[model samples]
Target: MAVPAPRTVRTVAAALSAALAATLLATATATATAPARAERQHRRPPHTWTVTEAAHAPGARIALDDTTGALSLAVSRDGRTVIEPSPLGILAQQADLSQGLRFLHRKDRAVDERYRAKSGKRLDRRVRMNETRLSFATAAGARLDLVVRAAADGIAYRYVLPAGYGDVLGETSAFNLPSDAGAWLSTYRVDNEGRFNQYTAATAPTGEYSDQALFATDGGYTLLAESDLTGTYSGARLAHTQGTGTYRVELADSRVHTDGSLTTPWRAMITGDLATVTGSTFTDDLAPASKVADTSWIRPGTALWTWLAGGRTAGQSLGAQEAYVDYAAAHHWPYEAVDSGWYFKKDEWDVTDPDWRTDSWMPQLVDYARAKGVGIIVWIHQRDLDTPEERAEWLPTLERWGVKGVKIDFMNSEAQSMFQWYDTVLAQTAAHHLMVDFHGATLPKGIQRTWPQVMSMEAVGAEEKRTNTAAHLTTLPFTRNVIGSMDFTPGGFQRVGLRPNSDAAEAGLTVAYESGLQMFAGTPESYDQRPLARDFLDQEPAAWDDTRLLAGSPGQEAVLARRSGERWFLGGVYAGAAHTATVPLAVGRGRWLVQTIRDGADGLAQDSQVLHGGDDLRIDVVADGGFAGIACPWHPGVTTCYR
Candidate 1:
């Protein structure tokens, strides 16, 4: 069973009231209950002494040295060290006070909290954890508390600040692996849509906003990211903490002020083997529980976006959008996101474009989609709603027209001011019952928990990556996705890369990636040209009940398996090595008729087989090619291969 979830304010207040009333009624006629003075005095909270500083993940420990005050990590392979010494430090604007911080008191305890996740690779219906908290104070009247949580899967920690704890500047929390460590780090962009680049830890770019840091040591692989965001605080990025030979947490701005108590987000580090790194759930682990009162409207499914499908299809305007609607209705996709130029004349940014504000056919389009059992969502530039009045002028009209959602785009920065505006937009859209998708935005930071209506964000280099390759495809499942929901909008069923195979390769992304809204980036007409490939695309799902990293690694190749309801779907890609692909069936124990799709005999043809799932299954993969299809409980007369 899932633990209690976060709810709207009123619901929380009501629950508290009911509990208070129950307590009053039960004790109203009874004598006051009290413990003996001696017993009461003796019952104090648990304490830990001589634990001035420490770091621990299950079955591992890195204690802080008293003389040096360096809190660092070390990776060892069977007693062979793979990392040089490094440290984690808390820094503030006041230098003397920063040095004054030291062990003043300590408390530790075991903890287990279970909660349901709204959506992710893993359901996490129940979360069990053990925590240790240490408190430190400076002579300058400022104090900082570190809360560390050790779970079987990963380790997470954060700083807790009491009221008037002095203004914190930032932290030195980067994983300082050996200088020679292999790494996969995304470019540091304010837009955060940069592609993953392979390099050494020493050569990884700094002085920018790279939300997560991932690297490989001879000891093991480690992935780092932040979670459980505190709204008032500015978001974080990475920068060279000069002379330390490591990147450090750089708060977005110098205006990190607090009037009352404030807690920083958890900086989580998931360290282990390849499977452990790829399968880690530390990011979502630190996310706050779902808080929406009624989440039925926040549905997950595939979508069709016109911008990705060549804005105007076959020289048809309204016909193009109608075709998109028809495609959704035919394939069971729930929504269609009609991108820019819907209201404008191809490239007009004016809000009052004659075709838009006055006589745009958006209302008629919405009505047409409704008749076809499809919901229509439109896009807008963030500048159009720079003020409340501007938003009021159109948000109501769109809602009245039965528009299902809106995609706000071109928010290319992560300044504190932009952060404030983001909160405003989320609240405003929810008030008007408008689901939202953020495009060209900052990396997600737990706002989805507070606002479930946020479907997905385009903080990743997806189909827009004109230079995309298999290396990029294989790396994303471990980096960009580890932080939050991404609008990959995958599926380009053609040989558009540095390889001969395309259909099967691109098709694999359906299972390789997860998003609340999985919008495909291809024309319906183009996909329809390839019927079998089109059928395969039609069956892909956006969310899953469970996810497994089946085989392969970052950059070279990868295979992923995801489950939805009773059926299972698997997708895998082999960049340049054509070989036998091994798939592990971790689902229910039964005879499953796996109608598989694999690279053709010559790497151009598509082949299929009906295999029984009693043990691991292997399929032929062509060099620079891939495969993806589905499996279900064996039934009569299922087709093994497509004609």
Candidate 2:
């Protein structure tokens, strides 16, 4: 299906204005006596305006204090407040819209639509929200519109500067949590590779935090994140207002200057239980539709990465790459990523050299892999392709070599310029029909939605960090991976000292972590030791038709069920101590032959059983271990199934 064009607020506002004018004549008699009221409207506009989702379960109420001219927002779900009254305002170059504001008009409408995604947790998305646009004039007469969208799962709002208004300076937006609320936050970093530590609202350090801050409250869980980040504005972080339980907005750049008008990214509050937040699509919903008109070429699948196990310089030779390619082909994997040492010395930046690939062996490996029905993904340092001229020269060369994708590494920044650079690179890759995986990068904020060719990004502290505890792995689905695809480089079966998770647990991450380009970070010999686990990875599909967080708790345990075609893959990981639990088979009304891969007394174990919907399947997860299984429809003759 052709991707739908985005709807602009101006067009919607014009239509709404015309409708309001037509109704004005009918209420003339009632409005005639309000002339005195109209005169004082600037000083005392509506005190409060609220918009609720279709279900009326989640809503956002904007309160304006006529006396102080301060605007605040409160959010609620299931009759419980998720966010208290929090400040809301935007600072602009022409005028400060943070204070002394007068409401001019308000227009509201219901939005409901569905679109197809190239790859994600789910392929088809149904986005429904209640939208309201509130226009306000600063004391200096600068016009600004606050557009709020209330979805059944969350609330999102963004600042829109009209054509006449100047550029933006900053914002005073904040998420005020309850005093007793506990948060799981990552320290702010340019590479966004910080551990998510737990802290009380009052005791949490007063410093910069990453894109998302997960708060656990009496009401439910709320993931604070931003979406639809474009080149017009800078990336954002949260700074704790020391001991006050409020986290204020912090922009990466001081000022933002754009063309005619500018629209800030949406500040989203995804409120629900762990399941709701894990399965929410608020991030993708807020981004623009796919820019790649022909998404048929985009394929999501697993790749065999040699760098993690081979120590960065492995697989540089054609013979060495051919072995990895052979492994991928034998296992039905789609691609093999030759990382870090293909065209340059260690820690070198030779990508832009005129004779960069003069003595290259990559073309031979690429052709050989193509013959074996496998694709090659080469890694390039960010510094080499930082310029448009460099990218223009290299991107087409990669295509000519039959390279399916590029794993660009070491970006380590999220300023406004870097964000624009990301967009430009994605567009260039799309033009050449090349896929991209961003490493050493910022956390994803709906970039996959805009550029479907962007398969995944390395925003979490994954395998390369060498410190992934079960707690960190479990925390990911609710935090990092919740907002977008995460490339955690799972499937580390080798007994490396750095890897602490059990073999079964390591295998489970391949399913637990949702990355379009799921890179298995293990040597071929290591993976061959456990056929059950290796077979599971080979059969699993990276993209899914449906996903459900069957059970989860941050830093503890997470169990997910993903469906592709007619098969359902279930995976779970547990932290700290060993535990056992009964996972219900909620794949809907059908008898299924479930194949289980789990931790056993000696090592990995496999079992098969026939079960009906609602039946309980008990799993014995070892300490810091996990389990996984695939469920398929029961057939009369076939006793087992593998996809």
Candidate 3:
């Protein structure tokens, strides 16, 4: 949808004056002699919201207070109620409240305009205030209450969804401003079409504003944030998550004075909370009926095969199959992926033909991989299915074929229609009991909590593309990875050629940085040649029961530690330059085994080595450089096992 033009300061002032006059006139008519008394009695009422239905209610209220804004909302079976900080002065001043009104002009652009129209008409002008309220309901008689309040500097919103909705659908809160106001603006859309659902839609007038969108999923809740139009793709944006029993989106009014692509400022956080809410929380709340053999399906530790290497004939290559099986068997890795070309054409292959059954070598290869204890994950493109019926038709067949999961790729990111598609795909995929990995998509929020089968996703470009740099990889762990698992296909066979000082060390560090399902991106030949790195890949976890953001900040240094069984894996990355940080050893107790990789002091080479154990180790590393260490209890039973 198109963004409306921003009104001029003069126009905004005039509108405010008009609105205030109307409010004053109404107030005078209601109470001519008691104006002062009424004004004095306008204090906030006590929180009276209560849960009326027992089974449907989550029975919670969320309150937030920040320098820029404050918000309060309640959740119950009946519905949600919200009260935001209203700009009382503006309402009392503006003359024509709708004078500066703007909306998306109907046009055929991204999708057919006819199919993309708003489901509801423009809300009554009376309800249009600086403070806003939104309510959502589920078929189970549960409801959500959203209250938005404006602060001196910005705005904030809070809400709680009923417990039995299974998962949140999608949410978007847009502002309709004046059409003629001359201002620079832009648009952004983020969606994880392949994994746990993450999608966003935003618009600005000139398409020149900077934007940043973030999604975080913790526990059983999701948080999303969107910053206002800025000039560059960098800035601080407020975010709220379900772990905190709230979702907040904030926009800052700023000017564009630099040269760069217009990026949106949006943040999303997802988590689950049975008690009080907290930010950056992760929870798992998979439906009881939908839970699979968690041990059998959710294996901890790496995969040897990816679709990129096999190229056009990936699906039908016996050599690739043998290579993958060999790598898995030799390394003790549990999984392998049959990327995009498996079911359909490699470049322009179609799924309709029977190449796999007759002409190609897939039948033998699939059987071979199974024999070697390697589970296969196939690749499916979002565009492959035109509608929900087609998805329904194919998913069941995949499940029957014993396909462990599907990697869906190349989804339209920024449209409302596609948002619905994202939600539908997750719902349908769950029905078939198949795992999912999203590629070429937006960042993940917290879908994993509600649907644990969504293993990982690829939003940021990883080692597979060849263009990604050590700096880019470093930025992800702190920024994107903070939200959840990223399918940054690591472990490329090709050595680092761009920076001589950095070799395979960056790749190794990246693998450790990503605590999600690990996909090794290099060819089987490359891995076989390097036994040491190959050994590390073999022991990597497929999924983590818990993830701890030990230390770091967005676009800076990041240290993440994840546990599976009795092992604790830690990875730290720094972007562009060198830095020092002290990280705590909290994964377990007693003695442990530690392996590390850090930049060499000579400044021209990265030192690759291992260390057995140290209670607390001091680490000093250079830019575009970091370290990876795995701490396993020196003796069994000394540390708590994640398994």
Candidate 4:
């Protein structure tokens, strides 16, 4: 039987009441439920103590040498283990425990031979005593330790960073045990890079792309490494290979078991001091506290930009500004985006030089946009801010222009150094009170939780380039979007003429599934060509206040529902072939005005049909398919609730 859905929160007071109750219960119960084992565990000598009893069902216990900061974690079950040695520390180990052996970090045959015996035998090793330091308890009441050691092969040496690198630093080992393990491992890393591209040849184990083999679990628990980037590696350079030396390694010998529940803790890496290395080569700077902000603005039915109606050159010539203003005035679209070439010279690739001043017409454009109710977002290039001075100068100017957000393109990914750069950009943009959209970047790493103003990013190949397939769109939400919001410029009016299977409606389906800040890619003239399609565009929401995952997973199919005020908007896409899904209307119960956009049986339908809420709705959809449903409260006296 399916689990009953949780009740929806209609008001802030109700949410606060629930939070207060939960906090009180936790405070009251924490003092009464002290474990005798915990007391005994705490009593052991700091240096010699190791966790013997499992804290939760599937837990890891750490033992650090008092004299030496050498550390080791005993996993109750084997899976992937990530150990952060110390602050400013080298990677200690990353290995799969299911095989019951320490996996080789690199597969360079020549490098591996030097570390192994003549008989190809492995070696056992111990930490050098003189290079170790161990201490327990700090002002923060966290542990600290380190170990300077060489791998068994001796060719690769490492210095482990001490624990307590952050306010709270610990290790995590996630694996499925033979039985039910209630909890999961709690290890996470901060993503320095913006998006995940392909593995570079220099970084790849072989001279070709190599897929990291992870043991699949049937009923077992699995540990998924989270990142903040996206895109295909078919022809791109492998950016990940640069950090192979510093990648996390695990050492273990067994597969973990689970009770058919996904038990993995979401992790966030905390770095510090951005201003010190604003444009420096040192990429280890921590994310500033200011970057983290509240995202409660996301409620049930908020609207984000799906496209800018008048910013494109074609739109300008055809009076797109007037069209968009009229559309917003008549229909109630919240935001619009001003795409590339506005800040720089039109049709020119150079991003740094502001051609807007010389091109007096640009200010008129921005002014005209503001005159309308729509918000304006501009495009930017990261390559322009090659130096700190440039970043300081350009960012402030963007804010002065009264721009709502800036989209940064062509970021450098791969290597720990670039990771620091990624955080720096996000921090600097936030300081200016401007939203950010990262293109050619890696996946999101919970930065949204810290900086809610980071409106959206473009890690995936969105609709702008006119190359993304329906299948690509279907798979993204479950995988990339699970991390955070994406700026997949949806609502493209231009259709690429590919094969018969490649059609514009398929593109529309892709847009429907994306649940982030939306942008339109075609000209206003092109959009107006199809009246029905234009109507759908007019009614679409640009931002979402709250988001919910209704069903599906990465690279397969998924459904998402976003809330803005009392209205609920939902969209679903299927990536693998064709499939059908049923979504529950828990939040849609009170009353709703339903709007749906789906691929018709003939596969050419663009506009969606509207329906009033009466009985609960049931929808049947096909593969490479799309569906959007909007629900609003029903009113007796009001004739039209929409507006």
lDDT score of residue 342 within candidate 3? 62
For residues 1-643, write the lDDT of model 4, one tens digit per residue: 2333333434666889999999999888877776865676666543332221122222233354333333443323223222222112222122211112211122111111111000000111112111122233323333323222111111011222233232111122222222221111111112122222222222324221111111112222222223222110001111122323222333111222212211121221211111111111110011112234533332211132324434544443214444554555454555555555555544422344455344434455456666765555666677776579988887887777666667777763533345557667767777776667677664554455345566566665555543545545554543344345556655554543431112333334433444345555544565566554556555555454454555544334556665656766666666545444555554544555555555566643533233443343455565455565556676555333245
**Candidate with best TM-score:** 2
**Candidate 2 local Cα displacement, residue 324, angstroms:** 0.7
| Model 3: per-residue Cα lDDT over 1-643, one tens digit each | 2334344666888999999999999888778758666665554342232221133322333332222122233322223212111211000011211112111111111111111100001001111113333343323333444543322111233333333333222223222112221111112324322111122212222221212232222212222333221222222223332222222332222321223212223222221221111113221110112233342454334666456455445434557667767777777777777765565444333445765334444555667877888777777788865497888767886776666777888874533345446667877777776778887664454445445566776765555554555545544543455445667676665545633224334444544455345777777767666554555555566555444555554344556666656677677766556556577665655666566545455422323222334345556666566666566666544332222
With candidate 2 superimposed using the best TM-score fit, by how many Å does residue 571's alpha carbon deviate from the native? 1.1
Scored against the true structure, residue 176 in model 2 reaches a CA lDDT of 88
Off by over 4 Å in 3: 1-279, 282-301, 308-316, 344-360, 414-416, 465-471, 493-495, 498-516, 528-530, 578-581, 599-615, 635-643
Q: Which runs of model 1 end up more than 4 angstroms from their true locations?
A: 1-65, 68-86, 93-98, 109-111, 165-167, 203-209, 240-245, 312-317, 345-358, 494-501, 601-614, 635-643
lDDT of 2 by residue, 425-527 (tens): 8889999999999999977788888899989999888887766677888899899998889999988788557877888888888888898999999888888
- Estimate the Cα RMSD of every predicted model relative to the unseen true structure: 15.6, 11.3, 17.5, 21.5
Model 2 off-target regions past 4 Å?
A: 1-46, 163-167, 345-358
lDDT of each: 0.68, 0.85, 0.45, 0.40
In candidate 4, how many clashes are counted?
A: 60
* TM-score against truth, every candidate: 0.82, 0.90, 0.58, 0.55
Candidates ranked by TM-score: 2, 1, 3, 4
Candidate 1 local lDDT, residue 626:
77
